[model samples]
Target: MPKQLFHHFNKYLELTEEHFQEILPFFEIRILKKKEVLMEAGNMCTHNHFVLEGCLHMFFLNDKGTERTVQFAIENWWITDDLAYLNQTTTDFSIQAVENTRLLTITHDKQGQLLKEFPQLEKYFRTIYQISYGAALVKMRYLFGLTKEEIYFHFTEQFPLFAQRVPQYLIASFLGLTPEYVSEIRAKKRS
Candidate 1:
C-alpha cells in the first residue's frame, strides 16, 4: 500500500500510523494492461478495486447485444460490482481496464476482518459507500428526467476528464445514445 492510500482513507476517517500499518497487509497492488478484463460476467467479484492510475469501465451486454456501460472509475476512485462483491455472488457485469491501470484491491473477507480489527475503517467505508449511493441516485434521476442531449452535456460538464479519456462510443453507451448521435452533438457544439 502507498502513502496515498492512507491519505485517501484519512479523507473520510481519522486514522493513526498504527492503523495504516495494520491495514496495509489487507490490500494488494495490481497492475493491468489496457483492455485487460479484471472480472468477467458470471464470476464472483471477490475484491473491490481502488484505482491508483488510469481508468476502468464496468459494463454488461444488453438483450439487444448492445454494450451498456454502468460505471467508470479513474484514479482515486473505487470500482466493483458492489452487489457481487458484498454478497459473494456471481457478477452480472464485467470490469475492464480502459487504459493501463494501477490498483489497490481488498477482498471482502479481508475488508470484514479489517473492520473488525479496526472499527474506524467501518466508518471510512460507510462514508465512501454513502457517497457512491448518492451519486448513483443523482445519475438515475438524470437518466430518467433528461433528454439524450441534456444527459450528454451534463455528463461532459460534470466529468470533463471522462470525456477526454474514455472512448466516445463507450461514453455514448453510458449516455444511452449511439456513437453517431454523440458525434453530431460534438459537431453542433463546435459550430
Candidate 2:
C-alpha cells in the first residue's frame, strides 16, 4: 500500500523517506464492494480516496433522475469532491465504487496536519491538484465542442484499460450519450 502511495505521489513530486513517513500515518485503507456509495449529495466529503485497485465514479443525479457521470477513477487515481472536502461544505456529487475496490483514504483534518508537519509534501499535493484542474478544463472543452463519437474515442485512447474493464452503460453515461449510441460507436470501431 505504501508502495502504491509512494508511486502516486512520485507522479507529481519526489518525496523523501522523512516526508513520506510524516504523511503515511494519516492514510487509512478501505475496501469497497461494487456499487457501494462512498459519498452522497448533501453530505460533507470527509475523505480523499486514492485507488489501489478497481474503479470508482463521481456523478450527480440530474433533474430528469438520470445519473450524469463526471469522472471515473481507476487504479492509481484519486477521487474526492474538492469543494466539499476543502471547504467543509456539502457535496453536490456522489462517489461510488464501480467495482470491488481497495482505497487509501485521507481525512481533511489529517491533510491539514500533514501540510503543517511536512511542508515539502504540500508541493506534491499542489501539483496533483493542478494536473486535475487542467484535465477538468480539457474535459469541458471536449464536452463543448466534440460529438459523442469523438468523446468516446478520446476516452478510449486516454484510458484503454478502463474502456475494457468498465461496463458499457457506465461509459455511455460518462460520455453523456445513450447506451445504444455508445454501442453503435463501439460496433463501428470494431468493424
Candidate 1's TM-score: 0.97
lDDT for each residue of candidate 1 in 1-191, tens digit (9 for 90 to 100):
37878899999888898879888899999999999999999898899999999999999999998999999999889999998898899999999999999999999999889889998788888888999999999999999999999999999999999999999999998888999999999999999
lDDT of 2: 0.88
Candidate 2 lDDT by residue in tens digits, 1-191? 66788877877777776777767889999999999999999898888999998899999999999999989998888899987899988999999999999999999999899888878778888887888999999988988899879999998898898898888888889889989999898899899
Q: Where in model 2 is the C-alpha error above 4 Å? A: none
TM-score of each: 0.97, 0.93
Q: How many backbone clashes does candidate 1 have?
A: 0
Give the C-alpha miss distance for residue 31 in model 2, angstroms.
0.5
Tell me the lDDT of model 2 at 43: 91
- lDDT, model 2, position 183: 84
> RMSD, each candidate, Å?
1.1, 1.5
Task: Give the runs in model 1 whose Cα sits over 4 Å from its true position.
Answer: none
